[model samples]
Target: MKNIILATTALVATAGVAAADVSISGYARFGATYSDNADDWNTASRLRLQFDVSTETDGGIVFGARQRFQTEENLSTGGATDPNNSNGARFYMSTNGFTLAMGNILGVIEAAPNLYLPTASSGMGLEGNGFYSLAANTSSNGGRFAWTAYDSAGAGAVEGVEVLYSMNGFGAHIHSTEYSYGVGANYTFSGYTVAVAYEEWDAAAPGGQVDGDSILFASIGGTIGAFDVALAYASTEFSGVEADKWSLKGGYDFGTGLTVYGFVASEDVVDESYGIGASYDLGGGVSLEGGITQTDEALDDTIVSLGAFFSF
Candidate 1:
């Protein structure tokens, strides 16, 4: 499998040399995860290869496309499968401060500027799954938050368009789909970035009527001395139902290739959750990371993960 990946990488890089720039990069990680609720230890790993290509046209417009091939190692099978599909392909055209993208594009809210988590491991064990509550036709699953502006990579090829513009430390994004639309803007000044976004989805409910749901998000991030800090808030509304969530994250860099970070969050339906973690740069595109997280809803429920990440 490793040899196959290497050969494919070489082939991809060699095929795009004619009047274009091509880059091949990827990430991989292997880790051990422990859950107190399950009382078991599990292994998790993921590999992703990114193919990026771009060229400047005669008219000075930049044209580009990107695709990612990913494989998640399943512990049950002890193997991974790389499916050849175009679900992750995205094309773009850009010049000056404006850019246009289509096909598997990110929604404005999902692409909001400076939106990130400081955790070394995936936060909350939900990975944004239970992060918000929006009205939709899908099963409620016991009333947990379960809606997002857009689906993540390899979600089986969606069609959308995104337009973005940036100038003088300010940027705006707009994305539209058949049933959903979003818009956002951000500005950076004095080492701080502030952004806000809103998105709405028209979902199909019973009786052939459309149910509208929306989300609003705001975030701010900046640096203070050796500490980096970020705060965010989100509110969702649908069918006279309203919910809100907020989180605060901070990280401190020791200037010695080691950093520590932590965060706390509160949501309307879920108990408050918090985590602390640290990462060390091993150099040469490798890093060591680990974290521990807990939620107050469970009895002795905690998750701990230790992982090594490789990037190239």
Candidate 2:
């Protein structure tokens, strides 16, 4: 990763000192995972490279773009090129507390604050958020999206616009595609933060009624003593099926470069999930981490994984 950054910088130097600032950074991860359900042990690894370019115009507007390239391997698939993981250029303009972005922009609902849990190993080490599913079909959750433009099944690079504003301890975000729209707001006071968001689709099927979906999410998070805690709830209606989900997560820092976190969430009727994990910072942008996750199944279906992460 360092070599890649150095080479990129050298190439950029040929431009003879441009106004834009360019930087490259990424991470490499390798882990071993065991799943009781599959009754097998597996290995996985991944590498990602990200480039960020930004510049300020004379008009006091900041313009920027972010792009990434990644490669990965899993026990089942070995190694394969995943073009979908590579995002196209996303451009943005920002000033003061307001910012506007377009092209490959995250969906409003998916980008809403406090929607996903924050953890060192991303919920379950190598597995990562095994059961924290959301209703946004445009997200990685694999749900069905009612908006044609925002659907992951569509071809070509995603196109959308998002507007964001933040002032004092308050922030708001709004975004839309051709057939979908969403709004979100968050506020921080004292040591607590609260957020809520809503999103809906406008697709009308042949039956004369709106055939799309809508989602509402709310969350609160704060630091209490040595632990950081959060709770979130979401209600969604997709294709006539309505489901509600709630999750609680917390983390503690030992002040010795070690942190532990855990979460439990339930949705629908029989769905339940939980995970616990810890990470130790080894310094120099490296860490060792491990975790276990159990889904709504028999106790034997749990999954455990351990891994090392490197960032540059």
Top candidate, metric lDDT:
2
Highest TM-score scorer: 2
CA-only RMSD, every prediction: 8.7, 8.1
The lowest-lDDT stretch of 10 consecutive residues in candidate 2 is 145-154
Looking at model 2, the pairs that clash are none
lDDT of 2 by residue, 1-312 (tens): 245335444544443433679999988788888878789888867777888999865545666888877666652321223423565667776779987777767665666555555654445665463534232321212232232222221123446677788999998988775556778899999999998888776864321215466778788888999898888887776666676777888889999999888888777644677788888999998999888877654232687878898889
lDDT of 1 by residue, 1-312 (tens): 245336434544554433678999988777777778889988767676888999865546667888877666532211113323223578876779888777778777666654556433334221211221111211212222223322223543446778889999999998876666778999999999999988777764221223577777788899999998888877766664666767777789999998887777676645666777778889997888877777546233677767788889
RMSD of 1: 8.7
**What clash count does candidate 1 reach?**
0
TM-score of 2: 0.80
Instruction: In model 2, state the lDDT of residue 281.
Output: 90
In angstroms, give how far residue 142 of model 2 lies from its true place: 4.2
